[model samples]
Target chain A: MKKLINKPEDVLADALKGVAAAHPELRVDHQHRVIYRAEPKADGKVALISGGGSGHEPLHGGFVGPGMLDAACCGEVFTSPTPDQMVGATTVVDRGAGVLHIVKNYTGDVMNFEMAGELVADSGVRVETIVTDDDVAVEDSTWTAGRRGVGVTVLLEKIVGAAAEEGQDLDAVLALSRRVNGQGRSMGMALTSCTVPAAGKPTFELPEDQMEMGVGIHGEPGRHRVPIAGAAEIAERLVEPVLADLQFGGSPGIVMLSGLGGTPLLELYLLFGEVAPLLEKAGVQVVRSLVGNYITSLDMAGASLTVLKADDELVRLWDAPVRTAGLRWGV
Target chain B: MKKLINKPEDVLADALKGVAAAHPELRVDHQHRVIYRAEPKADGKVALISGGGSGHEPLHGGFVGPGMLDAACCGEVFTSPTPDQMVGATTVVDRGAGVLHIVKNYTGDVMNFEMAGELVADSGVRVETIVTDDDVAVEDSTWTAGRRGVGVTVLLEKIVGAAAEEGQDLDAVLALSRRVNGQGRSMGMALTSCTVPAAGKPTFELPEDQMEMGVGIHGEPGRHRVPIAGAAEIAERLVEPVLADLQFGGSPGIVMLSGLGGTPLLELYLLFGEVAPLLEKAGVQVVRSLVGNYITSLDMAGASLTVLKADDELVRLWDAPVRTAGLRWGV
Candidate 1:
């Protein structure tokens, strides 16, 4: 695989420096490997924080802003950020109200963030967390660290971040975040495998005419491999399981058809076109929809689908304004 | 260049059906190629709307929710959606306050959305628009339609969506959206070209050792091609121009370092690592930062960086709560 970097070993350090230079509002604690909003949130606002392996961009870090996370701890390319890094983020962003850690359901992520949360809690800062187990792949996949936190992490951050921004207590924010996670389900597929910079090769080999279905974001093997089909068939492979897992037909829902980094918007939209009608046929009403590369795998050519059931209140909350580097709406 | 469609012609239609099925809350007006929130916004709320080609998924459509766009028009892959589709979306979502159209800077996207706005205005609906021209790539280049909208569109949608969800007047929303576009700039680099399914080939060929800089999201050629460099060098290539274009020093700003589809998160984070300190050394304070794949090329292996200068008001709005499929925060 071809790559752009001076040395593979220096990739992480070099990229962090570039990020700090490009974004003046973000402060990089290079020593701790954390990226945060330069100006911390107002005192008393519950700080929402998250982190994980370095591969998922705009995720734990891109999301650091006023309406989203207070700080993000980043690990080295697909490696979990060290516990020390998470502790540093939690300590820096904590403004007294408390801190909530939004952890994806990966073993390393969970372990690292949990350790950080504990370390911070020991310092008497309130720290609460919600683990996002949205990917319906498998609890113990051969390729992934575990059932990876795929798409729903985006939803959880936004929802929980909104709660924290509203000055909600830590427990309330944690509850709402957990609720959103509980109600959401996601599944992914990969057309082509990605090569980790460190691994220096495709994480997994996919045949030219086949796709890995139910793949996790971290280059994990999916539930099955099938002959690559049209956008219509691919949509079925991604959406059917999501619907079946959550029974989205009974109520209004919010659906996210996300690209796994390498898929084109054309194909994603085409997939949406195919997925939309089938949802309606199934008696589901999509109150809202989002398509893009929200939570992504490095450069894997694929997409993932996530569904969230919404009541009137959640819908109202959904409509609220927010400003963040990655997601800004209603501002 | 390998794709899975049964027939190239069936891509769009088949995909829409699948979208409708997976996301029941969103209704896909197949005839019009519009994806709308199943439930319209309250009466008198300015309807926020956006559209472009189908390839940039979860964009105009995925953003349709309470705090974001009320509806989105989708065109064929990499091609702008038709005026009729935009017309339909504007008409159905309009609640008397007016409609705001968020268009990217591409010529086709601008022209199509403009035509749709005209059609809607003819029908007696008040419409306003903001065209995002954030990509710093040269305009009217050999391979590009124009400076591609790139990453700033995501920021515009969220900020403008927040204003509209607050029941701000159409003019207010339009102004805010435009302000975001004006304050932001983006530049991208590609390691490998993507294959548009219809084209069934890479958009462009780059020698394995070379990379394309200042590339656009639609597989457009970039400003220059050079032998691939290390993460630090690549970071400098992407960041220098952005910093030169705007004065990021003195005041805090928002920075978005996004992957153009195929770049891995590990590389992305490494890129951020290189960027963070550069901004700090320049005496720029980063108020917010985001690193990820929001806007993308089909499957091009590259990344982009976007910088937006933010003020107190923008920062406050950024802190507002939002709930949507793509962006949810401050719940």
Candidate 2:
């Protein structure tokens, strides 16, 4: 495998070191494998924390900053973080206001965050959890029991993080998180499979002329493999299911077309060129659009589409200042 | 080639459609193929215009926005933009103050931009040209007489763009641009070759167990092919030549490690983790660092590092707000 890494086992540890070195504003807890903002939020503001397996970058760790996540519990590649790490982050970031755990709807992640919340309950810390499951690709996947959370998790964190930074209570943040989760829908396909560092080879074998539609982030089997087609047709495939799954029509919406690690940014924009028109034809009015690699699988050449039906409040919060390595603006 | 494009011939036009569709803040002239700030700069502020072949995305076009570039003329993939396109952009973006044409050191680009400057001289728009040759890879290569202008172009645009935005005159902005180019040095390597759309195949052959060090942005031959090694060893290989060519110790520097389109963000961070310490040990104090795909070669699996020795002025300008599709912060 051609990868810029020293050892497979050291991937997460070494990458965290790089993250700490690159972003001085972020504080990395080496021992616990948690990333935190150097400065804590205000006393009455709700603190946010999220975590998952490592490979999908700029997700939990890169999002740790003032306006997004307070702390991110990082696990090994494609593996869940331990409850102890989550407990440590919850207790540390919590102020007089409560803490919110923004988790994707994966079985291991949900279970671990739930366990951590219970473990921290005796410490007199109020922790509320909002699980996101916006992936319309599949109802159940390799590691998930229900819909797997995908790109909407990034949107939810940005919008809800803004609400929390503006001094919203935990209950209000939780409600907003759910609303964003419910309104957002995502569908992804892969032109190629990602090679997990430990695995040392591609997760799955896709023929040169074939692709996996409705694929999961972890290379889980998609709806089916089909002959590779033009970008316009692929955009229709990704957008049709997402619109069918969620009622995104006749309202202002936020759209994100994220690259799946190995795809070029030029192609992502090309795909979005096709995606935006399709969404509009279906009656979704896109107000804010992000076309880049916000959340990505490791070295997988593909793209995903997420459409979030937003009202004025969601749009305003998304427009608020955010200072994170992954997503930064208005600050 | 398995790119997210409809036809190889239609890549640039289709991607431009996406660029216009995704970013409402930027105005794309489909006919002239120029991306400009939707709202032009004020009359007295000097304007910055940059353009190059298309494959290396987020380079010229993505850098066009406030506090950065006033316009970017896009060419076909890896092909120089026409002289007429450059002439049109120079005349359109020239506020009462002069215009700065930021051209990379490729032969076709340099010649075309120079011709365009001469063509617009009669139009009465004062234009000053700055050709960047910051690659420390080789003294001269296939398409370049001196060094190939690589990642430093991105840094030059950001630092100098801020100067132009703050009302620096054409002469002052041109001086700053030259200073940035002179102080910055870059070295790149590739694990796999990028596939140009029209070529319908990999640009060059890279064996499974070897890598090309000092590789050019367009898959041009590098210094040599070496056995693939660990990240730390590769980091040492990239940093040694850069430090040897220039004295970078004892000053604050802005460092950027850009992916060549195909490497994962996890690996980029991991590689930066290895790169940061090597520079520090060499006495280059990295006051600021950017790790992502700012400049890219379609889908080559590798990275390039650019280090700019910066003083107080350059550092302050670098910290100023920049809001572009590729790089956005401090706003």
Candidate 3:
């Protein structure tokens, strides 16, 4: 219950105000809750847009800028953005090349983004949507019918945003987005449940001596609870499933060890130490590894591993200069 | 305490291993516990070195890279690094141009860095030191003689590091560091106490309905305990003292609303929203503002606000491209 928020009901709006205050480079649509670049890209360029809940910050909203999403629709805590908000963001950011909706595979998000896409089409703008379902945690969790999208969305936005910034057509950008999504796999665990601001308590009760093995970003029950383990063992649980699901050894891999909000970077670094050697043992050639909180579950003390099988093209795009608030490098 | 550590003693080593694994751009000296740039700067460059307790990550360690500290000495959690570690790091990174020790104003840190400077001088390497005492929480707190160096050290490192990268002499860099320290002030509050792994419990008891106002980064008791307030009121508490101590108006400013580890970005942004306008109304022109978990007190749910009065030269240095884990831009 000890969170740095005003009223639970006012979290999103207040945070957006902070976002606007901190990053004057971004234009905050206070009414629709969309974050757009202060200057939209020139005409005849692909525009990228993404969003889900507000809790996984630096994800959809923080990723908006040059070489990333042109705009990000911000929803409420653990809730999808409404079609109206998506449409408003799309209209503001779209150029002649059209807009792409990068929706994570959450039922509420998917359904809403689809409806938004159709609505945008009625406005005479072309829209392509890519649904990313890279989380290997569970097939069906508390909020989704399939694998829940997790960390891959951050990587995909960076790489695909680079493609869009390079004047790639909507088709090419969409193709690259889908490729990165398919090549990336993520697995996460939670030390404690994140208390949704609206909930006023932890989303779920996790015993003091145990952890959720494969928790979702929104506190969805993971595979099961297990007794709390050290960073080394926790690394095994996070990396094993992602490696099993994806063959990362044959190609250069882009890996990320992202904190689930509440975990400090000190511990996240410790987790990466446990996870990296195991990936190397499996013959995974990690060309680029990112360790920090990029995508997060609000105030959840745990870390997640994302392994993206990268070829030269993907690595090149990933290396391109990105100026977003969350992940910025090579610029 | 449910933390991702093998043992309290091993946390620093394990996290350093992870730092090596995740950041190939940086080199790790295991035995001495130092993080240095993988490629040292050419000889005859003013080298910047910083170290403190390991808990406030990305502070001293994460800032080591191209345009920041040449090497960062890593200490145990909440414990200042030993003089031996600092001496060893100084020996390795001391180009002919000498090294600058950026020490925070903690009793242990200041004393140890002073000892290390003398030891480094014994090796015939020129050394300059600057002590940052920007925290306005209390004139004299648990481990500080004056104001505790809370968040201003981060800004000082970046601005002064950039000056060093441009090959500023030790005297010039030292002067700039002093200027930054004099112009900046910070105040922080804690929603809850951080639990040190070694202690296996919260540092202190904080009731669910109260907050520690003006809390130090190391969970040192702030000026007083206050009833929990809204982000607007909390922002006022953090911003008022900083502005009162330093006149930030009439010139460009660099403001950072840094999370104390455990808080999420959503809330940090919300807090920033509440803080920015108040500063503006008070006549502060925040030319650059960074909001995130840059300096943290491991898993402590709170935040600190730093306002550094900057001039044209400092603003230019602040905008320079620097590659470090915590802060980066304008490459």
Candidate 4:
């Protein structure tokens, strides 16, 4: 594979080194592969930690900083981190107010985070877990037991992290995280497949003449393969199912057209241009929209759409000042 | 081309519609094809306007907001916007203070912006131009007369835009823009060629076994085609020329590893991880670093590095709170 990497085995470790160098605001635990805020918030404030496979960047690691994730336990490419790593991260980031494990609905990730929570239970730091299953693409994939969590994890971390920053109790942060997860729905399609570093090949074979609809972030199979079509038709196809799956109307909402890693930012905007009008016609009032790569399938060429039905609280928290390597604004 | 676009001709216009829908904080003049800050600063505040072909996104259009740019005129894919469009943008964004035209050093862009400046000069508004030719990849490419203005334009816009937002007169802002351009150097390589919508095919043929070294953002030829190497080797190839060409060592500097559209952020970080130590070994002190897709060729797989030697004044201006769709923090 002609990737910009040295060796498959060294990709995660080398990238973490880059992260430590690029962002001095974050401190990297090289041994455990955890990224923590250099100076975490005050005591009694809820701490947020989320992670998955390493390929979906800026997700868990890049989100660690003020007003977002306090720590991120990174795994190898598409592999969940060990429970020991998660426990180490939880112990390091947790203050008296407890820690929240914001995890995607992956079977391995869910199991590992749960095991880590059990390991940390007697350490005087209460640990609660909120699993995000916002992807409506499939009921379950090879790696996931249920619907996979995709883009909503990024939005949820920001909104819930803001509430945590306001000194909310762990239970309240968990409540807000679950609420955000409940309101968000995401669907993704891939024009091309991503190559896992270890596999040395694309996760799945995608024909040049077609695309995989409802693809997962780990390069998992989508709903089905379909002939390639124009962006407007594709935007309609992606949004129609989302509108049907969720009651996103009757309230101001947040719409995101996130690029699936390989697609250029130019086409992401073009897709959002096509997707926005279709949503409005379907009675969705989009108060805020983010169009870029947030959560991504590594080098998969296409896009995903997430529509979150936002109330005043979610909107306010989303607008709150957040300082992170991935998403930063309003500060 | 399998891009998410309806029609090649409609891509720019359709993307502009999406820009309007995504960022209500920025206003879109559909008739003039310009993106303007929804509400500009007070009278006597200098205005910044930069534009190029549409494929390199978030360069000029996404930078329009409170602190960065007052207006951005967009051209078609890889085609310069006409002098008339630039004139229209200049007339609208210019307060009594003056307007600074930040033009890339492409032949068409420089020529068109010059013509527009002459038009705006007769309209009783002063217009000074700063053309950034920071790319060290090629001396003269097909579209450029000298080194192409690549990623440094983004840095220049932010530093100069902050100066303008602080109500600096046109001359001071012009000086800062030129200074940033002079202190910056950039070089890029593409793993794959970008497909322009109108071309409906890849702009250039790139074999899988090799990469285009020193590739331009518009898919222009690089210094040479080289055998594909690892990220570390590629980083050295891109960074070495930049270091040899300029004195970037012994000072705090801004280093950005920008994706040329198709490369994933994960790979960008991996490349940066490989690039940082070499820079440090060369005695360059990186005070700040930005790793993401800032400037891009349409769906080309590769990355470019831009190093801007920063002084205390430049660092202060860089850290100043600026709000834009592409880069936002400290605001």
Q: Which candidate ranks first by DockQ, i.e. highest?
A: 2
**Of 2 and 4, which scores higher on TM-score?**
2
Query: How would you encode candidate 2's per-residue C-alpha lDDT over A182-272 as one tens digit per residue?
Result: 9999999999999998999999999999999999898898899999999999999999999998777799989999999999989999999
User: What docking class should model 3 receive?
Assistant: high
- Expressed as tens digits, the lDDT of each residue in A9-40 for candidate 1 is 66667767656655567788877888888874
* Native RMSD of candidate 1 (Å): 6.4
DockQ for each numbered candidate = 0.30, 0.89, 0.87, 0.81
Q: Which candidate is the best by lDDT?
A: 2
The DockQ value obtained for model 4 is 0.81
lDDT of 1 by residue, B115-181 (tens): 8878888889999988788877777754336566768888777777777777789888878888888
- Which segments of candidate 3 are over 4 A away from where they belong? none
When 1 and 2 are scored with TM-score, the better candidate is 2
> In model 1, what lDDT does residue B44 have?
83
Q: Please provide, for model 4 over B85-129, each residue's C-alpha lDDT reduced to its tens digit, 9 standing for 90 to 100.
A: 999988888788888999999999999999999988887988999
Q: List candidate 2 segments past 4 Å from native.
A: none
Ranking by lDDT: 2, 3, 4, 1
Candidate 3: C-alpha lDDT:
0.90
**Fnat per model, in the order given?**
0.52, 0.86, 0.91, 0.79
Worst ten in a row by lDDT for model 3 chain A = A243-252
Off by over 4 Å in 4: none
